[model samples]
Target: MKVLQINSTVNSGSTGRIAEDIGHFLLQQGHESYVAYGHGNRPSSSRLFKVGNEWDRRMHGLKSRLFDHHGLGSVKATKNFIRQVEVLQPDLIHLHNIHGYYMNIHGLFEFLGAAGIPVVWTLHDCWPFTGHCTYFDRYACDKWQQECHHCPNIHGYPQSWLIDNSRSNYRVKNQIFNAVRVMTIVTPSQWLANHVKQSFLKTYPVEVIHNGVNTDVFKPLDAPGAGGRYALNAQNYVLGVANVWDTRKGLGDFIRLRGKLDASIALLLVGLTRQQTDGLPKGITGVPRTESVEDLASLYAGAGAFVNPTYIDNFPTTNLEALACGTPVVTYNTGGSPEAVEKGVGYVVEKGDVDGLALAVRRVLVQGAAFRVNCRLKAENFYDKNDRLQDYLALYKRLCAVASHQTVYDGLQN
Candidate 1:
């Protein structure tokens, strides 16, 4: 089957890496796969398309001052993308996050909705339903559910227009999406899937598929001399990871947790600048994010437990990687991160309760080895290579059958 994957990115960043992984998986299974995306500094972007035109160029600074509509591109950019799609003639179009730079979403969806064969859209965030922001956290803004007038995150992502274009985007997306006969929504976590079911997009069928990681690469390391592991000086180590130390990842909680930890306990954080890490307590070690996956495994294996203090998430791959490496996780009792930590795999507590978080971390440290095994076990049972790859292959083949059936029906009508 020939598959076309549509996303804002292809290779470099987190979501781009995910799209690439899926593409490679499909290729290894003897299926023809191609990825289309915008030209970013990201790893391997093919089928480049610009976001806007000359008018856009003049208005971009003004727009940033107002709001940035992430998905909406210029009319010319949209037309070019449509022509590209027509030439590719993919059997099925699988879309990941479209919020990144590139592609005219309004035009592309309208065209796809009209030309629908089989389209599977993965909701990587709340951008599709929201007026602007990719995620709302627990902001609980119902504006997107309604007409999106007076949107909360108007000057947020996607559209940074001074006015609320929520109603228009919402209408267009709903009309285009619902018009397509073979459209399905796939979310990385059940938490996200449930939200999709509850939104204005209630009509679309939503399915859950957790992201997977390679076990061979993320496995335990017997010798931990790479980053210089501590000998657990009278206390255990609690670890945290963030591609960025943004508020969304709950860096505040990490600071608070470190303050409450016993002196012997160590806190290790990855992906922070030295300037960013300077103010933390003495025992908390700040390590720059490693580009090497093998090096990451050694770090995870050395930790007494892995902690993910994310305020919002949709199936974090980091959790999967830690679990694959037999590292116990302590996460909030909120979104999908907790799902990554099964019963014995790790601990989950109320969100923002530092005392509870610290206690949970302590509990995992106490029975750290057993919890570590459970983490690895969970990965083996759910996110192993064969299971995830097979699921995607089956989904693609099913879409192919549907597309063929639709083609025959269209021919008969003609």
Candidate 2:
């Protein structure tokens, strides 16, 4: 089988890594695979395509900022990509993300509809269905259920400084997106899948395949030596990790957690900017964001507990990583986070309850070693990267069989 996967980034970020993983997996199975990405470093793999140049990407972003015309810019670049797609003649076209100011989505979907090829779209977020926002949990908005107009999150991602075109955008998206006849939607979380089933995209089937973690790179290290390398004091450490720290991700809750916890318990956060670390409170240690999975595993191995206070998320890989590293997690009971915390592995506190968060942290620390073993067991069973992605291969085989049968039937009728 020949497969083409498209995403906004190639070898970095979560989605980019997922795309790369799929490409590599297909290659291992002795199938032809190609990856097309908008930005970031291209992997050294056999077949990788750059969708647009830096200038084209910048122009696309500019158009979106000025006119709220996201997914519609970079028309020529998208057309060129389409021609390449036709030449490649992939047996299956798998899409990860089409946003990020790189593709003329209307044009791309139109080509898919006309071609009638089997397409599998893995939605990392809800942006494809909604008019403007990628996430609406903070607002608890249901405007996306009926129609997306007068959008409250117009100022959010694909941000527009002027004019609200959500009503028009919604209509345009509905018309273009539904045109594809042979498409299946995949969501990483059942929560997002449920939401998709209630939206205009409900006509298409939705499958839930939880995001996975590479266990080989994320496994626990010898505990004592791990903290010493980072110059961390030998005290109980509550760890939090994010690519960025903001209120939406519970940065404020971490601050509050520090104030409430005793001085003996240290609060350490990875993925903070140097400036953000400079004036941190007395008991809190902030390390800059790391690209090294080995470094992350060391930090996770040394921690007493991993705390995730994110108010909005879709199956966070951080929880999986922490568990894979044998660290117990204490996460908020918000969006699929608690799903990562199985029995005896972690605790789930209500959202925004700093007191409850503090107590949960204490509870995990008290049973730290026992919980560590359970965490690793849970990760091995449910969140192993190789195991989770096998589902995709199964789905691909089923779809290919169906398409082959249809082709034969059509030939017979003609």
TM-score of each candidate structure, all chains considered together = 0.90, 0.95
Measured with C-alpha atoms, the lDDT of residue 318 in candidate 1 is: 83
lDDT of 1 by residue, 121-211 (tens): 8888887876566776657676666656566766555546566666776776666657767877888889888878877787877878778
Q: What is the lDDT of residue 56 in candidate 2?
A: 97
Residue 192 miss distance in model 2 (angstroms): 0.7
Candidate 1, lDDT over the whole model: 0.74
RMSD of each: 3.0, 1.7
Per-residue lDDT, model 1, residue 389, is: 66
lDDT of each: 0.74, 0.86
